[model samples]
Target: MIKPGSRWKSRVCTAEAVLIRPPKSEGLPQCGGVDMAPVGEEAAPADMQPGLDQGCVVGKRYRSEATGIELLCTKAGQGSLGFAGAALDPVEAKKLPSSD
Candidate 1:
């Protein structure tokens, strides 16, 4: 089970992430359409490749509503944040209105 402040790295790509929000329960965190391993863990052979073409970008945050899990991109790679079979969309920063 992943918890808040937990760090993980992409097994398939060069992407790395850290969990900001923990999931409600034990849920599998995936990136680039493959499961992610804990930081410092050996990379899985099955996840040693990019699953999606779009790929994840550096400095982007990804989250899931169903599980309430949030991840921040550390290193960029050809892997998009995903859970189960669905891809997680990048979190957009809200812009503040001008005080003019």
Candidate 2:
């Protein structure tokens, strides 16, 4: 139930859905393919702009290509949280006991 003008929320749902989907073509090409560049990158074509915009949740989780690290955009709750960090703060990362 998104409002008509709530394009941002719509985009967030779309992006989350895509991330949850199985790779279409298979192999590395499907999952994070060479052409499937990170959001806000020049390598990402204009056609993908709409999808990326819709997918990206401001002040939320985003894939950082440079460091290969997934960093939080802002404090939790303000933005849609990723699967692991749904309601958690980055400080909680260290609190979780390792399975090792």
Candidate 3:
């Protein structure tokens, strides 16, 4: 299982992310249609798919509802995040409570 706080980097682009929540099941997170490797590990050069290069925004949280996996993009890049062949959805920011 990929534990929370584990960092990942894209193999095909400069995308970098930190795991916020682990997936309920088993599977690695994919970026640019390729599996992301852990930080510090050398990544083999790969090609980014045409549509999968939508890009990941820095400081945004992406989540996969089906897998219960969530990741925070620490560094923006030319690749989108996904899992199990499905794109991960951006998490909406929670509204702060109103102060009287």
Candidate 4:
């Protein structure tokens, strides 16, 4: 269960994220096509699997409607974020109208 302030690190890439909106069910939040573990955990065999490799942009917001999850990119990396084989869509910031 990822909390609103929970942070996760990528397993294969130098990616990091913070959860804003979490899913109701326990859905694995993945980066580079692989599940991301908590920020701190016991040292385990590193996973060199490549996911989207398209890369993650810093300050970009990624969301998944199916699982009602949203995350903020803290650090940029050569990996794409997604879960369950579905790539998460980037949430574009809405533009403000100019006041003449």
| Pairs in clash, predicted candidate 3 | none
Candidate 1 local lDDT, 13-85, one digit each (tens) = 7888888887676766777677888988777645533445467777888888886878888888777777775
Q: Give per-residue lDDT, candidate 4, residue 71.
A: 87
List where candidate 1 sits over 4 angstroms from the true fold.
47-51, 96-100
Q: For residues 1-100, what per-residue lDDT tens digits would candidate 2 score against the true structure?
A: 1121111111122232123222222221111111232333334322322212222333443442322323333222122322221221221334567798
Q: Candidate 2: where are CA atoms >4 Å away?
A: 1-45, 49-54, 63-67, 71-100
lDDT of 3 at 49: 72
For each candidate, the alpha-carbon lDDT, in order, equals 0.76, 0.26, 0.89, 0.80
Candidate structures ordered by TM-score, highest first:
3, 4, 1, 2
RMSD of each: 3.1, 14.1, 2.1, 2.9
Question: Which candidate should be chosen as best, given lDDT against the real structure?
Answer: 3
Candidate 4 C-alpha error for residue 67, in Å: 1.5
> Which scores greater on lDDT, model 2 or model 4?
4
lDDT of 4 by residue, 5-82 (tens): 898888878888888898767777788778888888743435544547777889999998888888888988777887
Enumerate residue pairs that collide in model 2.
11-54
